[model samples]
Target: MIDEQDEFDEFSEAGEAEMDENKGLYEHVNITVDPKQEPLRIDKFLQNFRQNSSRNKISQTCRAGNVVVNGQIVKQNYRVKPGDQISLLLAHPPRLNVIVPQDIPVNIVYEDDDLVVVDKEPGMVVHPGFGNWDKTLVNALAFHFEKNGSKSDLDRVGLVHRIDKDTSGLLVIAKNEYALSFLAKQFFERKTRRLYWAFVWGNMKEDEGTITGHIGRHPKNRMQMHTYTDGSQGKHAVTHYKVLERFKYMTWVECKLETGRTHQIRAHFKHIGHTLFNDERYEGHTPLRGVNLPKYKQFIKNVFDILPRHALHAHTLGFIHPTTKQDLYFESSMPHDMADAVKKWRNYLEN
Candidate 1:
């Protein structure tokens, strides 16, 4: 029987071997589909495992005999059966430029030997990517850890979960491999607690409710995500939201995520006809604009100008400490812009 230490050693060796092979990214995961796992297309199944693999790339691999099911090449639409053996021969993705550590400042809300909880500011990308290749929270953490002789590699050092780039609030970073693995398991098992605050368009009729749907990439637009009803390709996502305050047109809401999908809160709210304020993609045009009241229209325009991104903040985070096994909770107040929006709306209502 393979013990935990042995398993870790094996993983380490495999990673080293892949590095030797000049593959920038490689992972071999073996999982048995649970009985609850609904039937999914083969390409979709493979896409879930490879985070950076595009759907087109997945399909091309399927056609090129890189994907095998039960030791035989299969089409993309092949239904994934439980207990079936699946193997993928994926080429390594192009290497990203080496990310140099930077001295970007971060708000450390709580810290211990095992982990650090940070109140990340809005407009700060968590990690390096695209146009945001430097001056990120990861770069700051790397610099800080280096000072203590605890630096980690590029793929992941302390990060376990991620909040959207524009979302402000509390986030946790693991200090070691044990903590990283434990926290990752918590996320996979849906055991962690995440809550958000958002100012959404329109007054909600219900005080509290849940939004359930399957989320996947937009069929035509590769950049955006959309709800899938045909079960063709998507993961089940759920969000529970309650109206905290209501104004003439907008509403302040507190949302809890039952399933954490990319853009889950933003997408789910939009799915329910209440796109978040300043959400350019989901809520394209401002309803309050062109109204007779010039003051209200100007207020709406100001809100948009001040906040250029989605009006969402990850206000609360609760999870078990990876190494200590102690329950940890962290919360952050809404950032200046969101607080200002709420204040102005309240003042408008009074007047």
Candidate 2:
């Protein structure tokens, strides 16, 4: 999850259709410079925003006219200005998905003839798409199915819903058409329960609250999401949250998603000005709270190093069984990175 990682990696999965083909080159990133953004060179700006991207690669792309600002090509040294519309095109076209099977391991918590429940680890892509084509959860499932010699009513497996690449948590996959239709309906009808744990910036104005908005792709940046509350854009989404704990500089909360949208929790928290901690795409990585004294600044840096990705996890999932008609719920323990960070925060607070 790089620059657009929250909503960037957060796509409206759950069977959202792929965008039209680029024919040859693909538009990988588009951005709308925030109104308050300070002047910076375009190359440096991109290098900072896109994780793991090298300056030489960015410079080379700029030299090849792959970087565009407001529909005009710009050089690496071109200073980015406020409200600038920037788009980056990858030189190569997207490879078609044959969905090659891989032997990647997945944590299958529950499995039946109808469905499988998996506790997906962080950094695993759910399906084959975009930069990830193979070595996905889907690929692993295919291998598992083939090895077990299981037959399904549907032509292929189905992912009931989707989580971001870097978001660790529970996911249900349909093994047959009946399971697919039944489980998919629950998600669409808002009958399923999806709960997330997130560490966000700032103390809340209240103990708990609901967030409502329409979420859609950012106009200037296709990888990120923007919320419109006037019912003017995207699909309606709702999230209910309650405070579980509070740190000196951050708040710990449990979020129940009433409706699933791409990056629903992350975008909603951002809309309310409590962006997820260490979320690079949403400006949460800049030490947004507390004085940057040597001791405190070092503390922030240590935690960031502990948990490199955004501080969000799909902690719990509940839904009625499609085949048995039994209600089922599963909760995952907090990942080590997050748990360790919380421990450090607790010690810091006590000291």
Models 1 onward score TM values of: 0.71, 0.71
Off by over 4 Å in 2: 1-97, 152-155, 289-294
After superposition, candidate 1 runs with Cα above 4 Å error = 1-28, 31-97, 148-156, 289-294
Give the CA lDDT, 0 to 100, for residue 50 in model 2: 68
Model 2, 78-103: lDDT tens digits are: 99888999977533222335656679
- Candidate 1 yields a Cα-based lDDT of 0.68
How many residue pairs clash in each candidate at the backbone level? 0, 1
lDDT of 1 at 158: 58
lDDT of 1 at 143: 81
Q: Candidate 2 local accuracy as lDDT?
A: 0.74
C-alpha local distance difference test of each model: 0.68, 0.74
* The best candidate in terms of lDDT: 2
